[model samples]
Target: MKFSRQILSSSFSLDKVPGWTCPWCDKSAVSGKKDDFRIIESVQSKSQHSHPEWEPFRITGTFCGTLICSDENCGEQVVVSGLMEVEERGWCDEGEYFSSYEEILTPLFFVPAIKLFNIGNNIPIAIKDAILETFSAFWQDLSTAGNKIRKVCELIMNDKKIVKTYIDKNGKRKEYSLHTRIDFFGKLKKGEREQKAYGLLMAIKWIGNSSSHVNNSLTKADIINGLEMLHHILELLYDKDYMRIYKLGREYNKKKGPLKHPLFGTRHL
Candidate 1:
């Protein structure tokens, strides 16, 4: 297992999405505070199939209960629990998706009541810039690696069997590329899969590229649509994990947080 300091962006908060409520505390949920948790364990095991190895990570952290309200009687408490593992096949050079299990807002929580003057800037400019900048950076960074990224996606789309090779009676050795995608999605043909994969992979590539390379020409509407389409594709492949990570992000402004896992408890952190 390995460890790293992956900063969970503050832009994501559980309370902002739907179905996230602190039952124990019985209050409208608060957003996950920035840098509130830590990853404790990570282990990778190569599958016998051709696909890249699978890396599983375990994380734990505490959520500070300060932003929801400032009651003199309410002592600041913390929420400690295990986190979800954000995984990536090879997208980040690290070959694993970075996860804090939960994303907490970073810059800090805001209290509208305390603002003596409204500068018309609802949120902090630096934080807003950071979110946009980081997202655009991902888009820009992947452009140079676009071909490689697409190839990986294609590999996942193809139908092939995982085979191990050994030399004949003579003492020779052999190696070959085998298909690992089958284990994830069984017996599917390439043509049947390519369009689906293309939709998913290309959406990601285009959206990321436009954000990075197109200046600010991308309107919020465009961004939303592109993201929704990408999310739909990711859902087909990754199902809940993919949608939870991507779609849950934009809903932070909603009245309620994203949906919750039956056993994972409230996602307020």
Candidate 2:
């Protein structure tokens, strides 16, 4: 499932709140209660307030709030905290324009975590754990999150039984890198699905490599891109329904009509 990019990247506003996906029940969206938001001015901002030329736009603080899932049955709760800043907003009233400063919260952390995408039950436990770790680290540390994503790649290799270490011609066993393992998986498997998965895995591996750098410049958007690719890979690998539909589609295209069953006769297109 593709996540809402706008919701994940945008700042939180009391007037127009962003809907966060419920971690417990991925189907439901969670919204914040205005009363639940607690904003505290930073010491630096408080000191600057005494200045003669202090402006609202210069104000900054930290905010914490509670978001409750909209689904009554789920009613899952999430705690969010972030940096709050005031920015100028303009509105026109009868052709007259007026500007005002508004508070916008940029989320830094979420407790219980928000779902980025659905995880299939068929995925290995190790991969699932790594994916969950990546989600938790996303808001707090992008670099760490990227590393976790790399860990998921390793776990994927393990799940597929791709050898981590192999004997070289020199009689020494060398550990294969994630890049090598992914390439090996592609070589071992033959199909359109494996080809697609190989391309996606390569992209994710590149992101992970960049994230491993000491002074990496990985952004939240970059991490989201990686997660999206991972989601597709998981579907390709573990979602039996997806495979079934793909095979059926190929058969239909080849015959240019509905497939025929031996017992049921020709099926409807």
Candidate 3:
């Protein structure tokens, strides 16, 4: 399933809102519990309240709240916590401009973990675990989440039986880098699908590399882009139904029409 970029990037106000995908059902959106948000101002921020130069932007605090799945059949509850900050908002009314400050809640953690995208049962257990871990790290640390994504590349290589170690001319075993293994896998099968998979993996690899370095500027959006590519890769490699449909399409195009079965007559177009 495709992810909702708006939901992932949104910051909440006081009112109950719906956007997050439900981790349990995977078919519903979760909304914040009504008037459930609680904010606790930091001591430093509170101390500045008495200052004449104090402004709403100077406010800083922590917030916690509850979110409930919108689907009544799958009304799962999730707890969320994050930093609270003041945001300046302006609007035009009757050709006049008015500015105001309001509290903004930026989520950093969610209990039971939210699903960023659908993970098929066909996926390997190790890869699934790594992806879940990446989801956990996504809110707290983008870089760590990126590193986890890089680990997924290694796991994919292992599953594909790509050579990881080989005997060198000196009779010593040498390990291959992730890039080399991926390149080898790409070359193992020469086809449009293989080339597409290689390109997607390479993009993910580059993002992962950027995340590993401290000097590199990594954003949540960047990680999300990698996740989207990884989702497509998993579908391309492991989704049996997807592969069957793709094969049928290729056959149809090759014959310029539907194929006929000897016993069943013409196959359905």
Candidate 4:
């Protein structure tokens, strides 16, 4: 596969958006890496289909590209795949620009939740696993995506220890397993920390139940609601603490060592 960097940015009517930036011009200096995309290959397909109304023909191609920093000045290359689609406008109709445009994010491919948590690194294994399925759900099956989102919730519950044990009226000890998803929601409704996640988790749980147990076909709205809710929920559970912990680490690292060493082990490095 041929590799190249493509900047992933939200498109607008404005043409020039991160495809390239002026390195030499200080006034327009873009202070980050570029070319984070690698071209898997260029693909094109042309076909004709009968349209009862106005659909005479359609042509579309998707490019799978590996993502890495193309900025030679800054050397950090991590691989992620994003698909961009190009289509032919000459067949049926045309837009203003070159008769075509590149789609940054589409149902055909999944867009990774960005670096708000850790700059595309330090994402948990569970989240990473769910992410692939989430994309698959986006394009292939809404029902399947809802299931994957529930997995993300389960993982979050495990990581956070959402279950609780308590004392009963008879002076007996009791514990809540939260073993099942229903049990998990029960806990969420009761605790302050868990309450923060209550509404979002409820929606996710409902989606899962609707898709899996009820055997109901999910709507695009259902899938989208679950996806967006999980995004924010994960951020609340995992990401909000990032700055707090980083600052604490910085403070702790600033401390100096003791006057004498017993085992000759350094207290701080």
TM-score of each: 0.25, 0.89, 0.90, 0.46
| Candidate with maximal lDDT | 2
lDDT over C-alpha atoms for residue 40 of model 4: 34
lDDT of 3 by residue, 198-218 (tens): 889988889889987979898
Q: Looking at model 3, report the run of 10 residues with the lowest lDDT sum.
A: 260-269
Q: List ranges where model 2 is wrong by over 4 Å.
A: 91-97, 168-172, 251-269
Decoy 4 TM-score against native: 0.46
For model 1, how does the per-residue alpha-carbon lDDT over 1-269 read when each residue is reduced to its tens digit?
01111221213344352112232243433334434444333233223223455223222232323333223344233343323333223334468554333333322222221111111233334433333333333222434323333333334343233344567678788743223332233334344333464445555455444545644455444444443443344344444444445445545535366545432336623
lDDT of 4 by residue, 155-245 (tens): 6666666655678899898864334544666565564435667677777887876777555877877776776676666555556364345
Ranking by TM-score: 3, 2, 4, 1
Worst ten in a row by lDDT for model 2 = 260-269
Residue runs of model 3 more than 4 Å from their true location after superposition: 94-96, 262-269
Task: Go through the candidates in order and give each one's C-alpha lDDT.
Answer: 0.36, 0.86, 0.85, 0.49
> Could you arrange the candidates by lDDT from highest to lowest?
2, 3, 4, 1
Tens-digit per-residue lDDT, 7-54, candidate 2: 767886788878877888888888887897998889999899879999
Enumerate residue pairs that collide in model 3. Answer: none
At residue 119, candidate 2 shows an lDDT of 85
Indicate the residue-level lDDT of 121 in model 3. Answer: 89
Cα error, residue 221 of model 1, in Å, equals 2.6
